[model samples]
Target chain A: MDIKPIFKTLIRNPVGLVLIATQVALTLAIIVNSLFIINQRLDNISVKSGIDEDNTLMISFSSLSDSYNMENAIANDLAFLKSLPGVNSAMATNSLPLSNSGWSSGVSSQSDYKGVEIGSAFYFADETLVDTLGVDLIAGRSFRSEEISYYYLSDELEPPVCIVSADLALTLFPDLNNPEEVVGKKIWYGGVENPKFAEVIGVINDIKAPWRGWSEPIFNRVIYVPHKPIFGKFSRYVVRAENGQLDNLVKNIQTELSNFDDQRVIRPPRPFSDIREVFVRNDKGMATTLTIVIVLLLLINALGIIGLVSFWVTQRTKQIGTRRALGATKFDILTYFLTENLIITCIGVIIGSILAMALNNWLVTAFSLSKLPMSYLLGSALLLILMGMIAVCAPAMRAMNVQPAVATRSV
Target chain B: MLKMNGLSKVYRTHLVETHALREFSITVDEGEFVAVTGPSGSGKTTFLNIAGLLEEHTEGSYQLDGIELTGLSDRKRSALRNEKLGFIFQGFNLIPDLNLFDNVDVPLRYRGFSAKERKQRIETSLEQVGLASRMKHFPSELSGGQQQRVAIARALAGEPKLLLADEPTGNLDSNMARGVMELLESINANGTTIIMVTHDPELAARTRRNVHVIDGQVTDLRTVFNNDNVERTAETA
Candidate 1:
């Protein structure tokens, strides 16, 4: 195929060239945005969940009686489940990290500190909670076995006690040089009505409750309260298995509890990682929808290319006939238009590549996505080139099929 | 040289059948300028189309430059047409997008001439048509006579064995038509076999031989040659 004439022809007809550019630009824009979204979801998935996923079994059960024996049922269930073979330890908590929906309250450093409201997810746990949930302690210490519930007092005259995450510590007192030192300070909550002030007892790393929901930067913002004083019955108990035999432990625990209450149901056991996945399910769905949209956009671009090429072949029928009469083989005619479409496609691909990069930046800013990686740009460019080939094939065949005699007559 | 034996073309439609040509036959020897004259809608154009390999005849035996035209593939037909024949249309059908020089150069490029060779051939052909200086001008920029000259130049550049001109001066005034006819005569005199289809009996009479056709059959054949001794006196008078 001679490319020189095809390029000359394309340069002469700016309208056809512009049509190709439009298709390429649209294709690249959608592809870049879709890739950016997928990358962001993947980044979210790889962030550490801050829990020992394998050795943990999260079992949620709700009370189903008119007069629920909240404290007795929970205590009895925990004791019974923990005594089962293969069970390392068990803790009853109102919510788990990365679980959807829970309570939040304003946390402040001093009793009278006037500041913007800071939201933190609340967790209620016994002393064994630290070992059972597998959260890290970045500073200070976990609540002692006997001292977990007595650290904070309801009266204003008594010394305040509570633990805030490193993130909350920073937000409450931005000038504080050390998060560990912030632990011993007094903070107040339950503004106006209860107005209780508490001393910081131990600061552990932040945790997410799927229900309460963390704002951005989850680790920097949760508040931990010991399981005593003001409390409600927890709906769930998580058992940590020492041997990672979660199935064995669930079987033994369910058997031990079968005689306690026939009406009480043990929900299926799931690893903590599987439980956390439910919190980010929306992100996965968004990524899948974006992929489908990009695929549809690519198909639209392919159709547009085919339409434009068909128009070109129709318009150039006489010229093709003339060329054949002048000594162009059928192969020559086919090659002429193939080279023409390819030339147009190459230009569009080059322009589309540039547009893809610019569109990636816009997507990142608009969607809070991580930076668009180079691989996505390169991959999309290649896909568009292949799309051009597929789009041109039908038109090329039509051009080649034109008879030389068509030029002899008016058309 | 060209030969046609039992040439036939049939057009089929859903409700009708039309025979454009039937059992048509003709032979032109080397260096002969044959004029094919017929009224509008006659089979002159069909014969030209078949002879030039532009359209296929339904049943025919055609030999042009010693190669059988029937049973040949479209590609081979295109090659034969490009290499062995030249075409001149009534409308001076030059590609509007290309300049005079490039229009002539178009066929040469298909012949795979190098860039240097294509340029040389284009200049020489344009010079032959007395439009060498206007080689860069487009066909629309020229007069009817000049445009036809360019078309002739386009055909001549290929150096074909046979030249086919359909209504060579059909669209021009008397003066411009005379000029185009003279150029074609000069080209034929250079030993290229020319078969021209013209509606003008006067123009057809000027050729060495005239074959007249009515409907789809040849009606008469005539040849005119005036001695130079009597022609000189007629010019002087």
Candidate 2:
């Protein structure tokens, strides 16, 4: 309760106070920011990709003869995949979700595709796209069998109709609150020289772009066009097996497909779980490394406090005895030391808030990071204060046990 | 008033037991100034520690201001020390980091006094000890005599019924020791009982009575002095 006097004495002899406080400040700054990044990676790793990841697998192959019919080959492959036992649906498409390969493009609501533009991942598939990828059609209707368009990448024609992801629907038509209202909005694409427009025939609930390790604003901004993209020398299909049958199908799909179409070289089939694993591998590693760093920093900070407070208790033994003899109870002595540390920790946290913000500002410039929230600072400050109290407990108890008779001795 | 009857203190270890006080008996009336004189390890400090509640005696009954302190908890003893007793030590024991005002405020803070009352008592006690002008000065900045005065102010600020001094002038020069003795006599004249332990016979002679101890037992030195009555001091020891 003698905070003013105790604080005055502490500030006059500030070496120990400054040392421990600097460690607290540094630890808080680093840990809070590191925790933010770790939470970010963790959040990304767990975000819903809006697909049935457990039941989907991808098979890709390259044909030996470039003179083959692309549509016939894709139709034949799809028929074989869907006829297999336990297979729910199948589609020959451009790329799979959460895979490293992607198709990104810019689209706009204005003619010539030049007004308030945003980038999006484009998926080219047939009428079975919804059934094959297992994405929910929250509003409007899927592509009809007669509306399906077959083309090669060499042709510069864009699909006239597409089903937009929920995020893309909201961005392209910001005024519309309901997804059903956005079902009829048209967006321009393909560039100013060859301006092409597509009507939004439907809206999927959600989906992520196949890319990772970049800014997050573009992940769910995607659109799936009803186009069966055909390349003469290359082909791929996404097949959905019934639950619990994906691993078995993945094991046998490549061999079966290669045997059925011997003119093409079939690559291995990968289940969606494997694609997701490869996507977040580096992010998980970064999160784990930062987590270890935060824990070690906290330990070092706690140890620094323990060492400093123990030394203070040792050096001030006679002072403690004097206070005890002056009618201070053991509990009073303990309170004195704890209150003193609380004051120092309070000062450190104040400085740490500023330091954490400063560190976050630098991170924003270097890595284009987001602003650090105030909750992180408050939470981390509470953590540091708790750790400080725990670290100083043993030394404070030692201080409390100093013999009152020490005052009568000739020190 | 203070009383101790058949008080005994034992220090025990795994190998040996040392009896610091053997059936010690002492009685001091209200407003009396008593001096306890003895050599080293002669139980002078053991008596002082027991009287101040700094250490507990193994066996005995101790009463201060008519309250029995035997078998009390540490919290109650601390409360009694803060409420009914004051102490001034040989080394002054002034916390060197604190200024004169804060040093004097130590005991009052333990007594749970309000900030206004604590400050008032601190200033008044410093004025009584002739250090009112140096309230902001640290103990290190003051002379030995001034530091002892600050210690006296600290003890006086509590306004206790009994004051205990353990070699209050052992570390001071002759002139400072005489000045401190005058202050103690002045404080005693204000109707507070005092028991000071000292090695200097000259200082012991200045008190109204003396109780000498040797080897854990009371020894009547029977010093010739201008005592109005020797029989009363004799009966107390």
Candidate 3:
């Protein structure tokens, strides 16, 4: 059980020990970093978008003819969609959550204030927008039916009323304890010098906008203006279905839209969940690739330990026999080998902990990744130690089975 | 302290069964030094292996210090070996990586001796072999005689009731062989039973008793040599 002897033995075979230790260290570093990144990506993809992802479908279209009347076309499509049998609510908006594109603007508490502005994604929709998106209205009331207006791009007019997300409201009125207190507050949008102010009619629960990055702190900040029948060459429709009717709605949406305006080209209609999947597809791919790399790294490290231990067993056959003849039992021999490997693995783990932190620091600086937690480093060390033991088992058993009579044989 | 009755060892194969030892029997009293002499391939090593508890006999009733060895589990057997027996090999099988102190410490470690006790025993055993000052030196740093001494120290550190030596001086020069033999004599004088296998006639003659074996059977050297001398005297008359 004296590790001093084991250390001396390892010192004698520096090359093999160093090689195995280096392999273990590298494996720990790579696996820890990969797992951290994978965990981060998983967390990013799991962020709640505050939409009824399963029940809502987003359908987009662009006007193919220059003479297409955007306002009338959108109104007809909305009415037809609303009349569908399973459709619970339908509203046209500039963008859909998890569709990967939206509009952003800077907002301020005071129209004349010239300071850092809070940035938020913009959503322009009608009174039915809350119902279609399934967003919870935590305070105040949604826009009135009469407050909705069909605004054109050439009209050069902004909606007088807007709903702000709870997060955005908190940014505007940080000292306010209640969201109801933020209801009558006014926020100025556009540039401070030429600001346009709108009353905060309602405070909705958190919702993520499509264009925001998962790492951004303001991902949930959004403002909704009461604009109906969005006037543009392209328009997005958010349609909500009754329970269990999402698939049916997605299937029949293109036909429904085309029946309203045959001159327009309709893109495919997809469930919000599918759009979210497409949006974070790269993140999922990254997680999968990192998982594979971690698995391969562990396997290679195990093989390296096995190979080095096997070679040591072969090289020390006579020594093992001598120990056996000198009253060392099979278990003693086995423990000696296992303990030796543990020492080597411990060395690697120490070096690997440092390397893992360094790599995480680099990631944090280079890609804005969160710092690696100490718990993960400790977990990785324990894992590698276990791997070292498992990898050394066979070779140690071989050493144990060496006959004491082997010492009596010459050479 | 050691006894074997009707011991038989058979080496089996698909084509042939080699009888390494047939109906072999031997006994050594407590505190006695006995030497076993045999030619190459004469089953001496087989007997030594079985006697050391390193290999199982095909059929035998063997007892060491009044404990039945047959049919014992490997754990029991190993425990018994660690508690009661020690071994020295001709090749001076000292682990090259370990220093002389640790080489002596190996058997004591297996015997479950406390670290302090192990250190004391290792130091005393090395000192007995006149290598106490060289305890820090590795086996590779020592001469042939010194390495063999370290092996002897390793065997002695357990304070075993029985010490088995297999050609303990085979790989040494005559001077070194003599030195190892003197060390063995001193150890035997300390009342520990000793069984040595040797091909050297001089070494065999030095022991308290010598047993010669050939063709898997023990031969009575006294009867055979006396009979030959009588025949030569009659031919001369």
Interface CA RMSD of each prediction in angstroms? 1.8, 0.9, 1.4
lDDT of 3 by residue, B99-196 (tens): 89887887787788898999999999999999999999988899999998988888888889999999999889999999999999999999989999
Best-to-worst lDDT order: 2, 3, 1
True contacts kept of 3: 0.77
Number of backbone-clashing residue pairs for each candidate, in the order shown:
18, 0, 0
Task: After superposing candidate 1 on the true structure, give the runs of residues whose Cα lies further than 4 Å from its correct spot.
Answer: A42-75, A82-90, A93-97, A100-231, A239-278, A364-368, B226-237
lDDT of 3: 0.84
Model 1 lDDT tens row, A1-411: 556655655675689888887678667867876877777776665555566667887776655664666666767877887777777888766566666654567766655547655666666667676688787777677766565442122323232355666777777778887888887776778775556776777666655444434345434477766653223322667788886677676566665665665555656666666776886687788888888888898888888889988987887787777777777788887777667777877787778778877876776677555677788777888888788888888888888887766656743
Each model's RMSD to truth, in Å?
A: 7.2, 2.6, 3.5
Task: Give fnat for candidate 1.
Answer: 0.52
Weakest 10 consecutive residues of candidate 2 chain B by summed lDDT: B227-236
What is the full ranking by DockQ, best candidate first?
A: 2, 3, 1
Best-fitting candidate, measured by DockQ?
Answer: 2
Give the lDDT of residue A98 in candidate 3. 65
B1-237: candidate 2 lDDT, tens digit per residue: 889999999999999999999989888789988899989999999999999999998898998899899999998888888898889999999988789998999889999999999999999999999999999999999989889999999999999899999999999999999999999999999998999999998999888788898888776554445556443334335
| All candidates: TM-score | 0.74, 0.93, 0.94
Q: Model 3 RMSD to the real structure? A: 3.5
- Residue B44 error, candidate 2, Å: 1.7
